[model samples]
Target: MQAAADQGVEAIRILGVKLINPGDFFELLLRFLFNLIVTVVIIRFLYYPHSRRKDYFFIYMIFSVVVFLVCYSLASVSLQLGFALGLFAIFGILRYRTDTIPIKEMTYLFLMVGISVINSLTDKSVSYAELLFTNLVIIAVTWYLEKIWMQKKEDFMDIRYEKIELILPERRADLIQDIKKRTGLNVYRVSIDRINFMRDTAKIRIFYRQDSNVGPISKEAPKQTPPVDS
Candidate 1:
């Protein structure tokens, strides 16, 4: 009978099933709720409003949950901090399976990962108050940076310029004026790409600020319609 009991214990051990404290489970649940709230505020209010990209809302939510569960599962580790840091370091190099991540989206990805790790790995030494405060600060800073301070500089468009004569180093002002007339944008600045002498055209990148605060500009600018050759 004793041998059978020992075998049963060993079986449970092998299956990684251990008795969990209810208090610890509750704490984890609370942390998950808090993190979800923070993530939603940042994604829905701060990010999506400005970007108008709905795809990342679900992506970030799912990613945060996955990361939180993984971190929570590894709670008994002696080197949990180092392990968590290494795990996020791995996430740092992540490439999107669907498409290449833009700089803004990638930054938000890092933020979501960081917040998930922090919430899931809440150390017993740190008070819940401190964690809440930390999350609030992150949300506030991101909201201010994204929606307020950097709003004016976010819109940009790319266009192809067939007026090779206006693309000269001396004619940069002319190029700016031309872009403003064509696009009806208060162009912040212009970046001239490689000039194709053979094609007699150059790609012009326009960084502009939208005047109204209604919605962001569409991602793709209209393709340049070059003049037809007679």
Candidate 2:
């Protein structure tokens, strides 16, 4: 019975089963917890506040979890380089037909994938301290760029302009003035997306720069209340 028990334990260890190898299980749990925390910090603080796109937020979080688990499972293999490269290639080609992801969102996705890969696939040659430092560096750089360095945020809106004549090259200044008066946005530039001749209206996209703290303006600005309300 003693010999049989020893063999069973050895088999469990070789198979990397959580039932007997508490150390391996604990290591996986610790790394997964750490990876999750890092992912939350990056998505919630560094990325979401600026973009406010819930779809991509969901994508990044779910993708991180799946990638981390998959890579951790495959970490026992010696082909780390080829496996890592293939993973990168798989993530690089993701696309959506309805709306192509913007470069900024794609960048955040790339960062999340890289972080998950690094956290999960480290061999014995790498230390926990080094893994942590790498994740911290990525978070620090992202925070600095999103919060400190870039104060101005550019936003856009699409509007249907009835004055198709004003969209002409000669009437460009007049068009801008009219759009500003109507929209109450500090419009810096405009692009004509589509022109509807039947309705004599054109689809226009306007760009404006505003401070990060300021909320984005709506498609139509709302009327302000009388001063007596104050």
Candidate 3:
């Protein structure tokens, strides 16, 4: 009876190993947790602030959740090719009718998705050094592309308009030109806010270009040519 009990115990241990290997399970759990944390961070820092429409945020969050589940499942099972093709077809049919996202924001989304995919496929027992190196590479590439190389100087320029009340017989072309020269922004449109003949002041709004900080405009004036000799 004792021998039989020992055999049963050994068989149970083998069964456990076959059912779910500790290394595989641990790796999956770690990947899931990491993906969740990173997704949350990206949603908070990148997605929530710039997105004006509430529907965009909602859709983005839902997409992230779906991506997480698909990646997790992929790591566990060898999905059939037909199913993968079907997924592609389904995603192709999804239409987002909204304002275009800036390149910077799109890059962040790509990075987040790439990281999730990488983590899902990574082996659990990889050395710490290798893991750290891979992470550093990802960070370095993302920073180089988004912050250093792809960022535009024009985006930093602050262009705003101020509304004023005044009345004049002619358009304020000279004043608008002066403001453009000083602010280095071309005024695109102007609107009349209010006009009170009795007050003798026409409320006007001036749209000008200015840097992010109201400072000396960087635009240089066109050189004046001397009069041609007769």
Q: Which residue pairs collide, candidate 2?
A: none
| Candidate 1 C-alpha lDDT tens digits along 1-230 | 97776566555543576444455677788888888888888898888877777788888889988888888878777767897888777866566444678788888988998999888877889998898899999998998888678866657777778988998778889888988898888886888867789999888888988754655677665699999999
In terms of lDDT, model 3 sits at 0.54
Task: Kindly list the per-residue Cα lDDT of model 2 for residues 80-177, writing each as its tens digit.
Answer: 77888898887666554346777788888888889999999997799998998999999999989888777777889988899999999889899999
Query: Each model's C-alpha lDDT?
Result: 0.81, 0.86, 0.54
Best by TM-score: 1
Alpha-carbon deviation at 210 in model 1, angstroms: 3.6
Regions more than 4 Å wrong, model 3 = 1-23, 40-62, 79-103, 123-132, 144-152, 155-179, 182-230
Whichever of 1 and 2 has more TM-score, that candidate is: 1
Q: For candidate 1, what is the lDDT?
A: 0.81
**Candidate 2 TM-score, C-alpha based:** 0.64
Please tell me which predicted candidate would have the highest lDDT against the true structure: 2
Decoy 3 TM-score against native = 0.44
Quote the lDDT for 196 in model 3. 59
Residue 211 in model 1: lDDT? 55
Ranking 1 against 2 by lDDT, winner: 2
CA error at residue 54 for candidate 3, angstroms:
7.2
True-structure Cα RMSD, model 3: 15.2
